[model samples]
Target: MWSDYLSAGFFKAFEASSGIKVNFTGIDSNEEIINKMKASKGRGIDICSPTNMRSPQWKNLELLQPFDYSKISTIKNANPAMLRVGHDEWNFGAKGSHWLPMIWGTEGIAWRTDQWAPPRAGDIPSYGDIWQSDVKGKTMMRVHSGMLGAGLYLETIGKLEPGAMKKAYDGEPGMRKTWQVVTDFCIANKKQVKLFWNDADSQKNGLLNDGVVVGQTWDGPPISMMNNDDPVQYRAPVEGALAWIDGMALSKQAENLDAVYEFLTYCYTPEVGGRSIDGGKDDSWGGKGHGYNSAVLGADQYASDDYGKTFGSVYPYKSLANLWPWPKEPQWYADVRTEYVNKFNAA
Candidate 1:
């Protein structure tokens, strides 16, 4: 849905203005990007999106090349904090950034408003809510992330050590110790999950058709549905939304350098960024948008009114300050985490 939305909305406009057609492919996870690029050594893919934390692993793999910043003049329109992440972390050899921030959002709770409400009427839901017997056999989540949320919930209730999830980044021993506890807890309650979503479409289907009363999901998909009058709402949980920045990376063996820079330049424009979030009843490019925040400055001004309202509802009480920013993952951490995920899925 993200690929199609961007292709139909801003990518189409970029084509009209620059005369360069984009061949877009929607990918579900960072592993997919890594595998596809590794198979070809980045030969066929010109630009690919990887979340910010995944940059270190991709950098270690030699799958990406540093961007020539001079060519992307419109980059000045990007949010300074987001740009700093690229410069500080993705600066391969400190020569230049290999990644540029594109879209930013959080993974949190989305529930069927008609079927379930938070335990407290006005309070934000907690990650622990998904485990309660009330919603058993009526929930959905992704394997890896749902376990992370379970760890967070355990932390909140004193079941696991404080900061257990974040400490998983410290080393393999600590990660295994912490994740084992989380895995046990999840396996014990695995019956609660009716579906495990891998992408936005699966998430939408789980909520609207698979009888999911509540689920962990990205902010974009459910918000898109809510705007269309689906009986659903997405909000940051009390443990904080797991935040990440999706980045545009240049392939090491990119064949279309000019087109790559053109696409980045086009994306960094404020109007393009804003419209990507909400197309504002524009029939030419579909009436809706991706339903997430843009990293470009002044992009909000051009977004539809629904964007403002939805933003308020989702981030009420300045919960943006409560976001749990994802820490960079080493290759070892990612590998071990995958093992735990596989175990949970099999159990």
Candidate 2:
């Protein structure tokens, strides 16, 4: 989506105005991009969008250069969470700076309002709820490893702990509880889930056409459907939702550092930010509103204009509690995936 827009007159205009031509390239995965950046030893691309989970990895590889805030005046207006300067031991150098939060969202339950009410505080539904006899064969889940890990954590540990909560990652009793819960839920509710979706459109179809009453998903799809007048609702559950950060960072080797800074400044503008929210379609998981909220543009007041009566009812990025920072450890992703795959296959 961003690539298409950048290729349009947007990049041309940006370049003409800033005297910097931005070169955009697409890579398959965060790991691939990181590896490519490391191979260059910090001289590859000017700007990259990698998941926040990779911050520590980039730091370790010395693939990022500290963001020069003095040159980017818009940094002051950004949400504090979006700032790059910070001291996190998990990041490389045991101290790191240089990745700016570009967008964010939570992984949580989305249910058919016609069939269910919002779960009360402390009563947010769990992965186990899908296994309840009443909803058997009527639930859906995301197939992504990160999302599945969160569901597993909620199931086994019953709630999120600040640090790594997986037994494989942290080797703690709480992690054990989380794994147990997820494993039990998957085993018992194997027949309940209609399907596990990897894409946003498939999940929407399952909910709208396949009679799926509950889904473990991100905020965009459910909210998009509801905005289009679908009988669905979503929320950040009491146990807290799995949050992630999608950020923009400069390549240590990027030749057009000035262009990268210009692009970052452009992205922070209200015009660019508003367009991002307005670009959301029902089938896409993340839309303009999702990006705007992640950029911390206050509440989602633009909904009424976008969806009419269907708009105001859907909440997007309203709670910091709902935003779970992605784990920084290198093996976190592989370990969690293995645990869930083992549990699911065993069941």
Query: lDDT of all predictions, in order shown?
Result: 0.87, 0.58
lDDT of 2 by residue, 276-323 (tens): 444433323234333224463532332235643333333333445444
Question: Each candidate: RMSD to true structure?
Answer: 1.4, 5.7
Per-residue lDDT tens digits of candidate 1, residues 1-347? 13523747666678899999988888888888888889898888899888899876976788788988899989899899998888899998877888888899999999999989999657598889889999999999988988999999999999999899998899999999999999999999999999999998899999999999999999999989988899999999999999999978888898999988888888888878888887853556566678888999989987877788899899888689999999998899989999999999999
RMSD of 1: 1.4
**Best model number under TM-score:** 1
Model 1 earns a TM-score of 0.97
